[model samples]
Target: MKKAFLASMLAAACVSATYAVAQTPVNTNNGAAAQGPQLSADEYTAYQAVITATDPAAKATAAEAFLTKFPQSSVKSTVLEQLVAGYAGSNNVPKTLESADKLLQVDPNNIRALALETSLLKAQGDSATDPAAKQSAYDKAADAASRGLKATKPAAVADADWAAIQKQVTPYFYSAIGIDALTKKDSAGAIAAYTSELKAVDVAATTQPGPVLQDTYFLGQAYYTSTPPDYLNCTYFATRTAIYAPEQFKSTFQPLATYCYKKFHGAEDGYDAVKAVAKDNLFPPADFATSVKPAPTPADQATTVFEADKKEDPTLTKTNIADREFVITNGTTEQAEAEFAPIKDKEVKLTGKVVSIADTTLTLAVSDDAKQANPLVADVSVTLTEAPKVAPVVGADVTVVGSMASYTQKPMMFTMTGGTIEGKAAAKAPAKAAPARRAPARKR
Candidate 1:
């Protein structure tokens, strides 16, 4: 989460040219040029020492000395700003942070200083070991980022320059704010902050691996974990991240995309199309909700499957045992009677796993609904003509031949009598031998 610090860029840029008092006044304070404020010979000499320094370390030292020599100088804020840039460019962490604090004391809303503060504090929070220390750093980061959001264009920076500066720094501020909120478990606040960040940054940035891309994924998580969860929005944003995530990280985001899609739409049938659309757009399209088809409810599925089954086998002729079980169990009393009447007392062949067994009675789970139970339950009750020589164990796959007798609709069990096991029964596991008893120990 380290930021591309603006101060580092400013460092070399600051020392590249001599300060022209005409075009950009060196003695400006709070964005207002002083009325011909003249520097003393000594002050001018010190100012030249700072502005003419060829390197960040030298410039920082010269600027610090100049500020110490002329504490009440008209260009104090300017010197502090450059000093921050110089320390930042030289990667002097403590001095960079110190100079930024100094700059903020003179101009509380200095955009560059606030940005550096947020970035440095956020980095500190990320690496801190103690809970209190991390909390303190994140709190400070959020505060600085909040101020950066409200920072106005300095009067000295032209309109065009201000516009470019905003483009550069605004997303960084919002991202910091969002991260702090996310860490605090404030989902709504995180969502708002990250949304604002996406709005502020170049759309293309969201597709790259960095603050914007990471925040884009975080936005999805915030939406998903928010109260009463916004699944569709989560799907859209997460799908986008999965699509653009770097190869090593691609798998990280796809599962959330699929899971949230299924949760919202009731199935993952059309998620790829959504992903296809998300790849090119920053936000979901207008028809997003209407586009995905929600899967049928359980009752709806039963009704549809039953009706199709009835049409396919009007007289129950050639209807498979699984289909017969479905219509009889789930269909209305009248529909159940219509299907069951045709096959009454007729022998049928069924394939399923054994549910339970006694000497001459076998219970079998013969339908999808029956087999899906936590502990498999029987859909068919069979009274065998005689018990098999080798006992059929529970959960052993077998084929049963029996005459259909009667059935109950609720909790759906069909009674069948004069049954026989017709195929190879699943092999039983070999019995384990008892372990040898330990020898009695001599009295201690």
Candidate 2:
């Protein structure tokens, strides 16, 4: 998962350090020459041997020998730095980390050492088996990144070279910190770090999209997981991730964007427009705003149902069972009683999908006046005249005939007695009211 992140850091470290070395002229201040204490002829010769070694393995061996022979040498930090670079060049992880630690011991603010240590620690954290060990490694990596962020350019490095190094290292530093915050469930901290990381790099121009896209996905998750979730922003960032993600990751992130957009807007109707906007912008436009379509009130829905029924059947009155159920569930008591009067004991037939079956009761989600994707609204609960030998399947369409019994508002459940399946007349017995049970909560 973190291969891209580690690869980018290794490439950047090699390129930045080598570029700086090639561009800068050799001098006493920047070279391997001893600084504070004047070196003896033998000590200077040893230092020269390490610096002039033709290969990384040879340089590492010579540097290690120099460090062991002259522990108090003025050029100890320089030798350790060479050892770090040499171990890194040879792809010797343990040796590189050991060398980097030794370099930091002598020069605590060495930018290259800090960056290397932080990147290595993050990789270790990602692969750690024990949770405690993982957290510890991530914490140390985050600490190193924090210190590296405040470190000034090394005195030996030219301004241009230092700027280039900053461009290469800054994003990875923030990425480590951001991933650490995420591991700790600090969403706000993750958001801040990832935001800074994205700002530090040209995300659109990045040759390695895996890490950047992964971070964008994590950023969206941070917004979603924050208290009082910022769903609008979540939608934007999640959608942005989908836009840039590889084929395999698109399916994972795209739905998150759609889900958040639908949740914030109360429906999926206008999500395409949001997805379109995300394709062209990393963040929402400055003038961006979503017109939230508030869910219709129960009373408003009842009124709409009443008007539509009247339009379909001009002679039909609110006393009709369906209309009565709507008004009784959504209207004031006086209006409810008035509409429920004629339908109380009258037998009526209903067609709907069997949403649930509990004992003798079958809950049917009726089509008319029922909101799409919401089963709780406009559901009819029918108490069977007899418990059928074979129960109806939950999602199958069914027709039931029953006498209207009672109703409940808010959640809008209808109770019916003397209920019988259309073709199961042989199962009929006697009418009896059943106790109402709450429907199981829907899965998100």
Candidate of highest lDDT:
1
Cα lDDT of model 2 by residue, 22-85, tens digit: 2112233434664354677678778888888868889899999998998998778778887887
Candidate 2 runs further than 4 Å off: 2-37, 154-156, 206-208, 266-272, 291-444
lDDT of each model, Cα atoms only?
0.74, 0.72
Candidate 1 lDDT over 129-214, as tens digits, reads 78788778878888998998899987767899778766766776787788778888899999999999899977887888765776
RMSD for each of the candidates: 12.6, 7.5
Candidate 2: clashing pairs of residues: none
Give the winner by TM-score. 2
lDDT of 2 at 10: 54
